[model samples]
Structures are given as C-alpha cells and as structure tokens.
Target chain A: MAAATRPPNRPPTREIDEQTDIGEVYMRSLLRAQLRRGLTVLAVVALFLAALPLLFTVEPRLASVRILTVPLPWLLLGVTIYPLLLAASWWLVRAAERTERDFAELVERN
Target chain B: MVSTDTAAWPAVLSVILVAVATLGVGAVGLRLSRTTSDFYVASRMIGPRWNASAICGEYLSAASFLGVAGLVLTFGVDILWYPVGYTAGYLVLLALVAAPLRRSGAYTLPDFAEIRLASRTVRRLASMLVVGIGWLYLLPQFQGAGLALRTVTGAPRWVGALVVGVVVMLNVVAGGMRSVTFVQAFQFWLKLTAIAVPVLILAVAWQSDGAPDPSRPQPPTVREATTVRVPDTVRLRVDEAVPVTMRGTLDGVRVDGPVVLETGRRVVEGGSEVTLPAGSVVPHVESVRAADGATWSQPLAGAGGRDHPTYRLYSLLLALFFGTMGLPHVLVRFYTNPDGRAARRTTLVVIGLLGAFYVFTPFYGAMGRIYAPDLLLTGRTDAVVLLLPSRMLPEPWATGVSMLLVAGAFAAFLSTSSGLTVSVAGVLSQDLLRGRLRSTVRGFRLGAVLAVAVPIVLSFATLRTSLADTVGLAFAVAASTFCPLLVLGIWWRGLTKAGAVAGLVVGGSLASGAVLWTIVFGARFTDAATSVGSSPGLLGALLAQPAAWTVPTAFAVMVGVSLLTRRSVPKSVGRTMVRLHTPERLVLDRGPSRREP
Candidate 1:
C-alpha cells in the first residue's frame, strides 16, 4: 500500500526533506505540542511537591493524622507518593504519544 | 545473644552466594557479547520490561538498599524525602530527557555532548565529568560494603571491599554491558527478595510484641538493659541525668564505677563501655540530636542536628529531581531501548520498581527505632538495617534474617559498582584511549581495571561518610553539569558550542568544589567555628547542599552564553532537532547520515 502511494504523492515528503516553509511549519507544530505536554507534567509535579512542604507548615496537625495505624506523613510520603508519580508519568506518556501519533497521521495524510 | 560464630555463618554464606551468582550471570553474557555493539548496549535489542529491571537493578545502589533506612532511623519523617526524590528523579527524566536522549543515538554521555553540540571541546569536558562522577559515586559503594561486612560478620573492613572490587572488575572486563545487564536484572530480584523477606519476618515479630508505637512522644528508651560500646571517641548529649555503670575512660579520666551522667554534652572516650538500666532514655551522639517521639514523628520538625532544615531539604530535592537524568550509568541503560518510546516505557517501569523497593525501607527504620535505639547512641545508625533482625528475633530466625539482609546489601554494592565500571570504562575506552588501542574490547577491559582499582584504593584512605550523603554529592555534581547541557541541547535550537562549554565548566567546578570542600574541610570547619562559639551558619548550608543554587545558575549560564553567541549556533541544528523529535516509525528523508567519531 505504501509503495502504491509513494510514486505519485511525493510532494509532502519532498517538502519535509527540502526544508521548505511547509515542512518547517509541520515540524514546529509537532515540537510545540510535545513541549507543551512535557511542561504541563513538569508543572504538576513541581506544584505537588512544593505544596506538601507548604501545607505541612500551614497546618502542623496534618502530620499527626493517622490512617489505618499509619501516620499521615508516612502514608503520604512513603506509600502514596509512588503511585502518584507512576500515574503522572503514565499520563504524560499517553499525552505525548497521542500528540506524536496525531503529527505522524497529519504528515502521512498530506 | 546467640554465639558470634553461629551468626557469622549465615551472613558469610550470603555474601559468597551473591558474589558467585553475579559472576556466573556475567559469564553467560560473555559468550553472547563478542562484538563492540553488544558490549556497549546489549546490541540495542532489550525490550521495555527487561530493560526496566536492568535499570532498577543497576540504579538501586547501597544508598537505596541500606542508607535510606538508616537515615530514616536517625531522623524520622524528613528522611522520606530521600527515597521520594530518588524515585521522582526518574519521573523528571521520563518527562524531559529520556525519549530524546534515546532518539539521539549516543552511546556514552560524551557521545551525546558531541552529537548535540558538535564540539570536541564540550565532549572532552563531559568525558572528564563522567569519569569524575563515576569514581565519586563508586567510592561510597565500596565503603558501604566494608561497613556492612564488619557489622554482619566480624571480618575486617578491607576484606569486603577487596572482594566486591575484584568481583565487579571481573564481571565488567568479561562481559561488558551485555553481561552486566543480565547480572543486574538477576540481582535486582535477588535484592528485592533479600530486603523484602526480612521486613515481613520483622513485621510479624513486631505484631507478636503487640506492635508497639514507635512514634511515642518521649525520648526512645531501651526495652531492656543494653550495653553500648563506643568505637571512637564521641560527644554524647544526655537529656536527663541518670546513674550508669561505666568502664574504660570518660571525660579524660579513667573510671570503672557507677557515675551520674550530667544533662549536657559529655565527652565519651573511645573503647568506653556504658550499661544503662532498662527504660532509660537513649542519649544520642552530639551530631544526631535526640528527638522526642512527638517531634521525631512530625514532618519538618528537623530531627537532624543541622541548622536550616528547610533550606537543606529544598536543595536536596532539587539535586535528586534533576540529577537522575545526568548520571552516566543510568543514561547508558536508556540507549538499550529500540527507540524513543521504549525508553519512556522503561523509565516508567523503573519508577514503579524503585518505588516498590523503597516502600519497605521506612518500616526497617521505624522497627530499628523501637528495637535497637543503641545505634543512635553509638553513631552507627547506618548499621540499623543489618542489626535489626538480630535485635528483634531469637536464635535461628535471627541468623536466617540477618543472612538475607546482608546478602541484599552486598548485591546492591556489586550491581551498582559493575554498572559504574561499565559506564566509566565505556567513556574511557572511547574518548581517552580512542586511537591508542587496536581492539575496542581490549581497550574496554583495560579501562575496567583502571576504573575499579582507583576507587578501591581511595576508599581505604578516605574517612567513611554515610552512603546517602556521598551518593547525594555525586547527584549534585551531575545535576549542575550535564542537566543543563542535555536540557538545553535537546530542546532548544539556539544552544551553541560555546554556551554548552561555559555552562559545564561553571556548573561542574562549582558543584564539585563544594563536594570537595564538604569532604575535606567540612568537619574541621565546623569544629573550628563551633570552638569559637558560633555556628557555621548560611555558608555551611550552601556548601553542604549547593544544588539549589547551582542548577538554576547552570541553566542561566547556558542560555545567556548561547544568546550572546547567537551567530555561532550549529547550522545542523534544524536537522538534529528533527531527528530527536520525530517518531521512529516516520520514515522521513533525514539527509546524509553522520559518521561515528
């Protein structure tokens, strides 16, 4: 199927190869989408980490709260943080992959 | 207590088993890894799952296996940040660095530097940092081995270090990267079982003891009459006065009778013995303050004696979050992925695997506080994990549990040291001995010997610090130097050769200089300042944890220099970015292929 289309639909591929204005636009769009997703994940993590210390400072009692015989800090920092990290990473992977997939389809369609 | 000979057998056997198993796995890889590509990156055929296991196996060093629990034992909730930061580092790596780095197709960090900036000077600078960081990181692994050995078996410290050094060198020299991958993956499981099984046994024992709360709001007390031995002369701060039977010298005078210890810092001479009655408060070494249960369990309460706890915390978190991306050994594992997406998947799995391993460490710390408070008094809290099993359990069970923990710790040292040797040897052979040698594999073998030998010799002469602190210093240097160069080089097109070089120099020197200062002058400086009746203050905190300042400054220098040298940007920047960003499935016409240097 790819071989059938390659003979006639060479213009889009040529544009990317020749560094034409259209190709530059295509590359920039993909880069921007991926970068935005990356930055968003970074911002979420930074906010989450920074807020924990501030929250502890604001309400010291939170540290003492216990759930199922485990203190709040132990529950949050030791146990809960791992799943949160995995979830965030999982989210980014899906988002980044989707963005890349969309760009791949767009380039191939042209 | 059970006889010393009975206890030694299990630990001794565990160490031997781990050593033989690690070398055996490497031998399997030896037959398959005959080519240069196989030696450097497992021929780039590893799938995400196996690759993730390999990365975690290699990444979880003595610091994670033993040091985290020890830190948590010494200082309560605040120490959790170390494990959190260590794992979260991979999150940051996945989000920013992983995929693009794999896409760049660089074998070593120096190769990445040259590929991105196209400058021989930048590559050379990066090569030096890789060797420096590798050696610095390996120092603690060797020391941790000796410490663990001495604590478990009555063997002299150097025996353990020599054993680990020889075993790791042989593995690296024989199989290189391919063999190390299998060995690391196998050890990761071995380590997981080694650490996990004991925690389960201890938890059961704790339950039988009625699951006593370790977070009580008072100074920790010995549940029974405990005799504490002081190895070196240490200053102890006693909170409340108590009558204690003493042997050896105290406060420059020899007294072997009962004496009332004052409620202040008392100098306890080396080789002194003190037996305190049951339910007495455990006096801590002056360096680690004794925290009451209420304060010890509270977050941000600052149990560690260091001033400016919040500042130190932030700096430590920053260094760890950014530094994982820059580690040469860690980065080299990512290149084993087939493409960009596999790299990301592998890192995500790594985060999960590391998190699973870390969840068991805090329990060890809390259990140690309840079962073995004497460690705090002895200033050997790093041995908390190794000693906990014996303190809590009786007879045969104690010996069995102790064996598992010691073997796990030894596995941690062997796997991490071999990983470091491979990375350092890879860089050494490629750039340092590029044209000087005929065969790549032979050069790598020679590099492996040089890499492992230096740190083993240095570990003997240097005073041992906590495993976590030494590893943290290596992270800070990596975060300051390569973190900036890779972040800017991959993402930003305007980054020039001049800017990258400037950032590496500024960041590398400052961070490493701080590390050197902390290692050599830190104790003397603190002592001198305290003798004159003043704290070392802000200057000391900054030097101890420089990453909070160094990372941002590195980013700034790279950007500022690049902006100033705008015209010197590489003409191939566009092509490089395309290669880095595009999906591997997209068969774009990416022009002429660049030759390997």
Candidate 2:
C-alpha cells in the first residue's frame, strides 16, 4: 500500500520473495510479454495450417503442379513444413530467452 | 507373406541383437541411478542434445516407424499430415508449455496438478488420466510388434507382443529413468540408420530402373508374375476381371487351374494362393478402394475409401498439435532438463530431429506403390516399410536390408514402450501406492509390473487397428483433458481448483468415450461393410474424430467454471506464477514442497 513504509534498503528480489504488490506487477508484465510471444507463434501456425487445406480444396488443380517433379501437396506438407516448423520454433526460443534476459535485468536493477 | 529362405534367420538374429543391446545399454547406466531423483528424472542433469534425442527416440513409436508409410501406400498424400501433426506438436510445446513446465519443478503431471492447484482431488483425477492415456498409447506399440514379427519371421502375433512386454518391463524395473534415457538415445540413432540406409538403397534401385513415375492414372500392375498367398480370409474387389492360375478353393468350390476372376467382391478362403501374370491389375482388399495412381498421389481424393476424409484430417491435426505437452512420457523428459532455457533448447532440437526422421516415411509409401503393390491385396499395408527392401533389391541385399528394418521396428517398440511404462509407474508409485510401500524403489518396481501388465493384456484382447489410428486416439484424449490443464495452469492465474476438476472430467470423459466407441465399432464396421454401409454416417464420423469439438469445449468449461468460482482461487496463485514465469537466475523463496514427496 502507498501508506506503507519503503522498507529501507530492501532489494527488489526480496519484494518478489515476500509476494508484495510490486512483485505481482513485475511477474504479470513478464508473463504478458511471454504470453504475447507464445500466442503470436500459435496464431501464425494455426493460420498457416488452416489455409493449407483451404488452398488444396479451392484449387484442386494445384495438386498436379510439380516443383522438381514432386507433387505440390507432397512437397508442402510432407517435406517443407518440417523445416519451417523447426525454423519457427528456433526463432521463438531466441525471442523468449531475450525477453527473459530483459526481465532479469529489470528486476535486478535495484 | 511367408519367407522360407535362410534370410529370415538374419531378421530373427537382428531382433535378438537389438534386445540384447537395449539391456546392455541400460545395464551400463545402472550404477549412475541411485537416488529417487535419478530414478525419476535422471537427477535433472541430461544435456539438451541428449534429452532431445531421447525424446525423439521415445516419441517415434510403431506408428511413425510403420503406420505412416502404410497409410500413405493405401490412402495417399493426405496421410502425410500424420507426420506433420506429429512434428509440429513439439513446436507448440516449445512455444508454450516446455519451459514453464520445467520451471514448475514437478516430476509428473499429477505432481504439477497438485503443485498448481493445491488440491488433492485434482491430483487424483490427473493421475487416473495419465494412466489412461499411457495405456492407450502403449496398446498400439504391442500390436505393431506383432505385425512386424509376422511380416519378418512368420511368428504368431502374441509372440512379438510378449517379447517386447517382457523386455520393457525388465529394463524399467532394473534401471528406471536414467538407464532408459541412455537406451532410448542409442535406439534413436539405431532406428534412423536402419530406416535411412534401406531407403537410400531403394532409391538407387529405383533410379537404375529409370525412375518410373508412381503417379500413373491406373491400378498398379506387378512388373513380374507375382504370387500372393492369403494368410487370412480376405474379401476383395477386382475392378477388371483377369485370368489367374489358382491353387485354392474359389467360391467354396475346389479348383486348381486358370480361372477368370469376376469383377465384384469375392471372398477368398484363407490359405488360398493366387498367381497373377505380369502387367495385370492388383485386386484391392475390401477395406480400401482400388485407387489409380493419380488419385493416390493427389491430396483429399478420397484415396482411403473413408466417408469424410477432410473432417478426419483436421481433427487429427488438432489433436496432435495440442496433445504433445500433455503426454506423460513427453513431459517427464522435459523435467530431465536442468532449467527452463535448456527445456526450450531441447524441444527445438526435438522438432528438427523428428522432422529429419519423418522426411523418409513418405518415400517408403511412394516406393511401396511401385515395388510392393501386393500388400494392397493382403491389406497388411502397415508392413510396407518392412517389405519394401525385399521387394526392391536382389537376394543378398534384400535379406540384409529386411533384417535391419525388422530390428529398427523392434527398436521403435522397445523405446516407446519403456518410456510410457516409466512415466506411468512414476505416477503409480508416487500417488497410488505411496502409503503401502516403505521404500520408493520397491514401489516403482511393483508399479512398473502393473503398468506394463494391463496394456499387454489389452493388446492380446483387442482387435488390431492400424497403428497410426490407435495412437491418434491417445493424442485426442490427452488433447481434450491435459492440454487444457497445462495451458491454463501455467499461463492463467484465475484458474480455480474447481475449474480444473470440472474441465478434466468433461474433457476426459467425452474424448475417451469417443475413443472407446471408435475402437470397438470402427473395426467391426470396416470388416463387415456390407452389413452397415461403405462409410460411417455423420454421427459416426463425429465420434471417429472427436478432438475438433472436444478440445474447444474443454477449454471453454475450464474458463467458465473458473470465473464462477472466483472466490475459491488459491491465495498462492501470484507466488506460483512468479515461480513459473521469472528467470531461474532470480532466486526466490519457493515453498517447502519444491521437490516431489
């Protein structure tokens, strides 16, 4: 509470350990940032996956088109999608670790 | 389908070698695992790369080893979604549950439930569901073993299941999680080599054959005169009548000469042998349609003869994408990582490893279309991977490659079965039998026996379905129940204990009910299609693929129930969230119950 004393010389980590109001704010902000990253990745995956069936359905003829003699659907779903998944996950891990590093810096600044 | 040559000996030899090697690897790690932490989670010291390999080793079951290719051989391109859904599931885990779950410091799913909600009831419910999902997943591994052994060595179905069950039980009881980790990582490399080498050889053989296109718009014809011996009574449909030399009873009449097969559904008695001339169309088993090459190669062309292929595909995807984190074995592997960052790194590498493994399955399916078309008639398309090597190469090479493939298939069975058994036994020992036993190790050993015993019995009793389909049902159940729990438990603070209980009950019952219905009725419906219909109606389709509806409903119920019971929210939620979200570097006063009891 604003009326409470500053608890002189107490560190921010102690506030978190004690579960003070300010500690809740710090945790909430970090969770929100992480949640945003997670949801963004999820939305991108959901859209890409959903649109694939739609593409094949609306344009059945595209199935016949071949790149390097492999069918489009086979190339897209069977082979290429895996590397794409790996890439997306790699990018996400980096972004998340960076967010955590920033949060660690903020919490320990005091 | 029977191989009488001396080559079958090598295949049998390879299986024995793999089994011995598995136990040997576990024995080497035996001394390292002494404490309860070592037994449960390898003391949380497994490095990222080793953990990733162990995860993949455990994750790629009989379904990935055999079923994916078989589906592709019979159904076509749409079935590729199985591998995609499988690999992408880890991506979702990496982005969402992997790091936070590791940070939660829970050894099992039930442990996580009790830690987050502080409720005994929720933990009990989660333990039951963990046992349920683990058993469901294990059933397919045993059946796949039977199928593989039969294909390679002419053994009866039960022999393979019994062998794998006994091996896995011994390993888990002896070494626990630490030894199993080393064995699994070793098996992953073994399996990759076993499958990848044969694929390369087959690819070269195809090239030398001028790389014939497999997508021709006609029924695949045998390049040479092929003799197919029916192991079981099969009802098959011949699209075009052809004269064939036969040596068995046809239409219940004894005939041993050239006869023109009629162009409708005919029931061939078991032990009948039919020899078709070169360049003749392959008659398809009743369960699958006789699809031309174009239809087989195209996506969503109704290649598998199912009523609603599109609905099934999407539903399968939904279940897999959300289900990976909910797997007890999978979550247990994450706990072996030292921290949240290592967990994320391990998951990322896992996605890549899985992707690399999956890239070869579709190749087997396509090659099977050309080289092993007789599998279509026998309706044992799941044997495509095992049989392709024999069909594609000459005698010596064929025998040798076939041996390697059978060994790889066995590796798939052993690694996955052991992983599932350990996780299930962990839960059992910790929660179910905690009061009865004095020492943790004795309890875990007893728990391992019970865990493997039930699934082994069920594998013998239940009718055999395709490996991928049975595994898919497991994912669906997990997706409906634990997916909601993990996602909400880690990310949301408002999730009350009552809400978690309500969601698990609703989601668990609905998804598992659909699974039970599909397993019992779906097999019978396929076998006796004339009695019911060619395809299941809308209700049957909905039950066949329940994840599309059940997952969302579970999420909704959890959120709604939590809001209504706002007053009952755990007072420690903020502290729990801090532990879950903050970086591991920032030491905080975690509660006394940080470790599993």
Candidate 3:
C-alpha cells in the first residue's frame, strides 16, 4: 500500500533482489525471523523429549503409575506424545508464516 | 513348515487387488506426465494436505507398519521410541530444513549438494550416499514383504519379495511417479484404514473378553490344542520346564509322543511339528530376553538385548530425531510444494498424519503379547500385526480382517519401495549415467531395475534381521551423513566442499561399516556368544547403534574441516544462502522458478 502511494517518478520502487544490499538486508531479517522461530520450537520439543528418558531414569517408579487404565509410560509415549507433536507443529507453522507475512509487509512499505 | 491348508485365498486376492490398483494409478500418472518437470516434482503443484499424506505414505514403510508393533511386542516399553522418534523427526525437519530446502529449488539431494557446495565431486559423493541409503532402506521393505506374505498365505518367502520387487519396478519404471502424489496419498489412507478397522474390532473383542492386561508376568498360553511348525531350525531357550506332545526332531532326539522341555537351550529341526496341549506357555527363542510383566511395562529396564540400555536409548533417539531430514525419498517430496511456506505447511500436516497412524501401532503390539505370543518362539515377531486380527477374531470375520491387513501390508511395501526406487533411480539416471545413455528416461528405467535388483539380491543373501533394526541402521547412516551436510549447508556460510566430502566419507563409512559388520557377523555373535563377561560387551552396544558417536563425529569433522578450508568456500555462498532463506513471494532474480527435470 505504501509503494502504491509513492510518486510515479521514483524509479518504480525497485523489487527486492538478491543482488542488492537492501535486498540482502531484507533476506537476512527473514532468515533471522525464521531461524528464531525454528530454534524456539526445537528447544521446546527437545526439552520435552530429553526430559522423558531422564524422568524414567530419575524416578523409575513413576512408570508404574496408571493413568486412565494404562501405564504412564505407554500413555505418555503411545498416546499423549502424538497430540503434543501435532499441536507443536501447528503452532510453529502458524508463527513461521506470520513472521513471513510481517516481513513481506515491511518489504512492501519500503 | 509349509501349511498344508494353504487356503488364504482372500489374503492372496487382496494383495493382487492392491497391486492392480497401484499399477492402474501409475499408468494414469504415466499418461498425464509427459514433461521432465512432471516426472521429477509433479510440476510443483501439489497442495499441503495431499503432499503431506503422500509423504506419510512413502515414509511409513514396513518399519512403521509392522516392525514397530513387532519390536514393541518383543522389547517392551523402550521400543516405544521407534514411533515417537519417527514422528518427532519431522519436527526437527520442519524446524531446520523444510522451508529452506523448498526455497533452494534443488530437485534432489545431489542437486542440493551441487547447488550449495558448487562442486561436481561433492555432488557425486552425495549421489552415492543417496543410492547407498536408498538401497539400505529398500532391503527391509523387500524382506518384510517376504515375511508378511509367508505369514499370511504360507507362500514361500521368496514369492512375496519377488512379487513386491516386480510390482514396484513396474510402478517406478512406468512414469517415474509423475502422478505419484495421488497414488501415495491413497495408500496412506489405505494403510490407516487397514490398521484402524482391525484394531477397532480387536479392541471390542478384547473388551468383551475381559480386557486382560498384557503386562501380566505369566507366560502366554494356548487356549486350545495348537500345533506349531518350525520352518527353519531354531534354538529356543526355555525359562521354565514345559510339557508338550512332540512329533519332531528336538535337539538331536526324535520324539513321536509327549516330551517335556527342560529350562535351557534346545534346537528344533526344520519342518518339525510340535503339538502342545491347552494352556502351555509359549517358549521363546534363545535370542529373546525373557521378561516378566513388570519389566515389560517399564522403560529402559530391559532393552537392547540387556546391554547399556541408557546409552542405547540416547543413541537411537539421536539417530531417529535427526535422520528424518536425510531420507532421500522423504526430501524429494518437499520439492512438489510451490513455495517455501507451502513446504513448511506440508511438513506440519505430515507430523499430524504420521502421528495419527503411529498411535494405533502400539495397541497392536500390546495386544499381540496377549494373543500372538507364539510368534516369539517362531522368531517371526514381525508377523504380530498380521496374526493379531485372525488370532483374536473367529471364522469369517477373522478372514475378512486378515485380508484387510494383507492389503495394508502390501500397500506399505509397494508405496515405500516405489518411492525409494524412484528417488534412487532418479539419482542414478542423472548423476551415474549422465553421458553413457542417450535418453534420460531410458537411463531411469535402467536405474529402476538396478535400484530394485540390488536390494532384492541382498535380501535373499543376508540373514534376516528384524525389520525395524535394519531400518534403524539406515537411519544411522542418514543421520551421520546428510543430516550434517544439510544443517551446515543451510545455516553456516563458511562450509567448504572439502568439509562436506570429508564429513560424508568419515560418517558414511563408519555407519555403513557398522551395518555391514552387523549383517555379516551378527548372526554368529548371538546373545549366547556376545554376553561372555559379567558386564555385557560395550563394543557390541556401540556397534549395534553407532549414531550417538557417529552423528556427533560427523558434525565435528564437518565443522572442523570447514574451518580449515574456509578460504575455499564458494564465491556464490552468499547468493545461495539468500535463495535458500528468502520467501518466494519476495521479488528476486531467481533465474527460473521451475526446474527442467
């Protein structure tokens, strides 16, 4: 919208290309945004998964706890983990696209 | 031990039906796919959900379909990591690789290698690794097919492998999966329904039968007079004295009548029939560790054949979590997306699809312990998924359920085998046969033949390892090689071609060497031989699952070499990184959006 309102003689608001320094800056921002979101998701997921084996080792008796008529380990691994993964991926994808859209908006404003 | 009553016509018919449907879909795809773009990446038009389903179809090989349940049945709680790691691998892929790879516009892993490193030599090395990994992955699909067919129809083991090999070859050679997206998507649903419907029925039946906990420590017993036939000579270690009527050669002694087995190892001759009266606990093969219900339900208590359970668990998790990004067939599907964002979306959906399918596998495994415990004795634990339906239900319903599973199993083999053949053959045709052949299509057909042939031959020659374990070896190789390559290639700007090659060579050789050693010497060094000292040998555990060391070694070597060779970094590194990381919507001077082939 900002580009559309600019003066017509201003060289047609050159599109962002990899050759330009400005475009490189734009691309860097996008990559940074993406990498940040990716690492956040990775950290959350890794923490949960890494915690599982540690939990089993630290409190070996926790496995004997039956939740909804199944062993806690089976319930966590066989049942709950699937939904957790689904939700995490959903959140990450949504956040990733939002970041992309925001970057696009920034590029458009220039 | 061929069953005289080979009357599984329904299962045979279902396998045939699946083959016909796959061929029919492949033929339609062939007609529709005329251009090189269509054959390689479906013209980059696939939507997120459909592409996600196709990925799941291709990814859920015999390892996921049958092996997970089999491993869970035999190894207990620790085996749950197989499915969890499989699904979570996508999480890592989505976070690290998916969007960037799609944006890179490289059609194959070798193509990506060339694009990132700017070296033909590195490309060739990547191609070799792709073929190696593909062949290793394909081996288990063929072997699993053989085992599945033999279990279902009592057909000779070779027939199933032959049938799957021929069928997959036809599909790959036909149009090179120009329309593979639809075929694979259909197969995903077919596999899901196959597992889900039977599991639902079995669950209801289980509930009606009092829903007994499978974690009970007592050994499983036959409800009626059952006769078990051993097709191959097997040494079984009995933990308890078991009384049975025998009409076979047992440990160099022939018995035509009743005999009691003492609690030690005994060898039974091939083609021998052992009839057991009602309520006799099933004897386990000597390699399988005997576990009570309490130990079976607990994690890390009894795993990796009773050796370094904690270390093995971490190592296996490392391999599987990172390995998903490197599977050739899995990565190629990402190219079908129109943009980086769509690729990420597809991966997100794939996590959900794969997660849903894996949830039911553990149920099948847990139920198998109760109903199909005899498989432990037969050393055919992989048959648990197929046997559970028929074992639990009686008569006509059992036959119908069995046929459903047979179709699903065939779908698993066909879809995965075809996917691997296409990816492998693509690399072979492009890189290996570049100047030798006049026509790329012809070269692809030749490559398809080679791709299917080597694995089939190897499947026949090698001693059969458990399907999932064999798959895990492939994962380790993939994690050690491509995982490092992709991560460094995408993220780090200073990565040199020399670094990639060195890392690949070191990582690939070590992981594959371990796999080859296992295949060659694993049978000889059985549980009896490996557990010589008080402490189970650490070398055996390391060799068994080398991902913990090999993956980190690969990353270190890659980073180390890249730092040394920083001056040789490609001049185009900045441009390539820009292309890989930028959103497609951003106007940029990307030469052509669509690749020719």
Docking verdict class for candidate 1: medium
Model 2 stretches astray by more than 4 angstroms: A1-10, B1-6, B248-257, B528-535
For model 3, the stretches where C-alpha displacement exceeds 4 angstroms are A1-25, B1-6, B527-536, B591-595
Look at candidate 3 and give me any clashing residue pairs: none
lDDT of 1 by residue, B545-569 (tens): 8999999999999999999999999
**Candidate 1 docking DockQ:** 0.64
Candidate 1 local Cα displacement, residue B406, angstroms? 0.8
TM-score of chain B of each: 0.95, 0.96, 0.96
User: Which digits, one per residue and each the tens of the lDDT, describe model 3 over residues B15-123?
Assistant: 9999999988888878888876787788888899989999999999999999989888878888889899999999999998999899888999999998888899999
lDDT of 1 by residue, A1-110 (tens): 87886655545545676777888888888888887788888888878987887688799989889999999988899899999999999988888888888878888775
TM-score, predicted candidate 3 vs. hidden true structure: 0.94
Model 3: how far is B451 from its true place, Å? 0.6
Per-residue accuracy of model 2 over B1-597 as CA lDDT, tens digit each: 322123458878988999999999999988899888889999989999999999999999999999999888888898899999998899889888999899889999998998899999999999999999999999989988987887788788788999999999999999999999999999999888887899899999999989988888888777777788777677888888978888887778777989988899877787888888888898887777778887887777778577787887788899999988899999999999999999999999999999989998899999988877878877878888998777778878988888888889999999999999999999999889998999999999999999999988998874647788888889999999999999999999999999999999999999999888778766675542111123367777788778999999999999999999999999888778877878788877766548545
Off by over 4 Å in 1: A1-10, B1-6, B255-257, B525-535, B591-597
Among all candidates shown, the one with the greatest TM-score: 2
Of the two candidates 2 and 3, the one with more favorable TM-score, higher being better, is: 2
Better of 2 and 3 by DockQ: 2
